[model samples]
Target: MTTKKYSRLKNSFICFIATTLLILNGCKTNPPNAPDDTTDLGKVFISANVLGAVIWLNGNDTGKITPDTIEAKTGMHEISLTKDLYYKSTENVEIIKDTTIDLHVTMEEILDIGKVYVTSNISGATIFLDDEDTGKLTPDTIATNSGVHQIRLQRPFYQDLSKEVTIIRDSLITLNFDLVEESLQTTVLLEDFANVSCNPCVASNQIIESLTKYTYGPEKLVAIKYPTNFPSPNDPFYLANSEDCDARMLYYNISFAPTTIVDGILYPISTDSVSVKSAIDQRLQKNPQFRIHVSDNIIGSTYFTTVTIKVENGSGINFSDLVLHTVLTETDIEFATPPGSNGETKFFDVMRVMMPSNAGESLDGISQIEEEVFNRQTEISTSWVTNKLHTIAFIQNVVTSEIYQAGSTIE
Candidate 1:
């Protein structure tokens, strides 16, 4: 019985050992369709001619410098290497799974590179370097190749500031600009109210033309003539722009033709050369309180005018009820036949149209040392000559009817 029991125990021990060995073998071997335990990735060994170049993989910064190894998923990739003061180097690389590729870049160093810090009295002025826009404003620094460069600053209502700067290699320089404000030129306005049908207007026009065109020229005086309805309502200039013509005539209470108004002062029925010259001379002696600039351009059938007014000195001047009047005049208009009873065919400074309206443009918030720009455009009339068109701008007080300053785009 004892021998049989021992043999049974030995058999049981053998069975247990066989089962344990089978379980151990199942854990050691992998299933047929199981996935891999390790990832399939590639590495890149990157280096540059110059050390310390930043590395970029597929346009993303890898936060790694030169002479480093970077691991990436197996695919195509764009590699970029960049360093300060050196031209960037780029290369396309194909990454194979479980493989490392060596990449060496020959970087070109920029020669004689320098830095410039630019500033202006007034900030935010546009900066131009070597006549090309740098797309940068003032109070900023710029990096460029060392050489001679032209720098300019442009701002509204201020004169452009320019300078030639020499940039030295490996050095920094600062440029400071003390910009000047643009001042207005002193000018006198001659407002003439006359009729083509009035006989005396011929002499008045001749005398005024002599004084304005020859004696003073446009440098000091600008003249504009308003045709009137009196003496004859058939006046072509009057009939063409009657609203403005009559409004100006009534503004000065003009009752007759051949009347001249200088600097908003009426001279009724006086075409005297000596008196008119004296009025213009006296007005010219006054200092310019405001600056007026007038520019005109014609595109197709459109007449455009830009009037820029700057307050040079607002002291002791009435800012309230300030009006800026822009008028388009035909400098010289000749008719084959007399358009009125006066038998006159030639006219100078004849009013064609008032910009915006006959009432003129009212200005607000006019203060000392400030500038305002007004743009007015009108359709050119087919009957009016294009080449003879002129723009005249003036600043006046609506209450006192005193013209402060005047300018024109004659020249």
Candidate 2:
């Protein structure tokens, strides 16, 4: 070959080799990359509680809306979502190669809570708002939603009072309840003497129960039924404690199956509602010369009570032989079968025990304005329901057998 032609051919051969090397280099899997290589991408699905929210990634606009999926490099990424009038949501996400991630966000609504105060004539009245029990009593302050609601105050003796209230945001609403007492008079005591075996006692018991159901209260009229042996020899109540029954029987000189005594005066043998109510009305008309207050603390089957008797507006009648009688009574007593021939299945306000003795404690005479206090501690028997027990304390004129004042406590 000629020298010039050989040189050209050699150059062409070099060019061909260079072009082949370039092609091989371009097809290589492992190539030189920048410092922040974002080629390895992952996917993400995002959703939020609010609509029309803008999404941002790594402080830069992703140009994507919520409930949409996006593609990004595999690494830790900062995501933020924002909407008008709602809290902004921020999250940190880690993306993995060939893996998809899901994100959900929720925004909170701003609300202003209000305050409500409920009060009544007596304390411990349960408060209810919009028929929902607040688990609060009278003279209490409660945090409630800001709106109009119905309010109800309920207690044992006092009539339930209801009212409508409107509460504004960040405002206070006060509700006052002048609850009316059920009985129109002060405290009164009713002593009932009966024999459980006597069928007539059932009618008398029904009459007394009817009166007590509407007017019964710790502060109003209270009753105690004595089960005598004549009615039934197997009387459960009489057998439970016979000493108290015998003592009360001797005091009242009771000989009948059903006899009701109001204060100190005995009513006619008729258990008619008119006759019973008449006797009660006469006693209620008279203003009691003294006031009694009873309080108790119960721990398990043991109960401790404190009673105070304060004489007020005494008409200068110096009482002789004033006795403070503390009696324990049980209500809502039930029996699987009738314990006597009376066929009564339920008994209420049955005398259980007398503190000290049925003879009672002697008290000093109150001339005008004086007071007497008594403290008693008693351990209840397991045969009786502790929750159904109560305490009754009264001052009586031993000579007249008249109950001047009385106080009772169920708790």
Largest lDDT belongs to which candidate? 1
TM-score of each: 0.58, 0.55
What C-alpha lDDT do the candidate models reach, one value each? Answer: 0.77, 0.70
Query: What TM-score does structure 2 among the candidates reach?
Result: 0.55
Residue-by-residue lDDT tens digits, candidate 1, 1-411? 242244346556543553354334332232211222344678999998988998877654566899998876678888998676686689999988988889999999889899899999988777887764555899888777788988999765578889999888899999999888765556888888788788889889999888878999887999999977666655666666666776686576555567687888534334678878878888888888887777676643567888888787787866767899999988778778888877888999988778888789887676556567799988766466667889998988989888999989886
Query: Taking the tens digit of each residue's C-alpha lDDT, what string does model 2 give over 217-239?
Result: 55567788877666354566766
CA lDDT for candidate 2:
0.70
Off by over 4 Å in 2: 1-185, 215-218, 365-371
Question: What is model 2's C-alpha RMSD?
Answer: 38.6
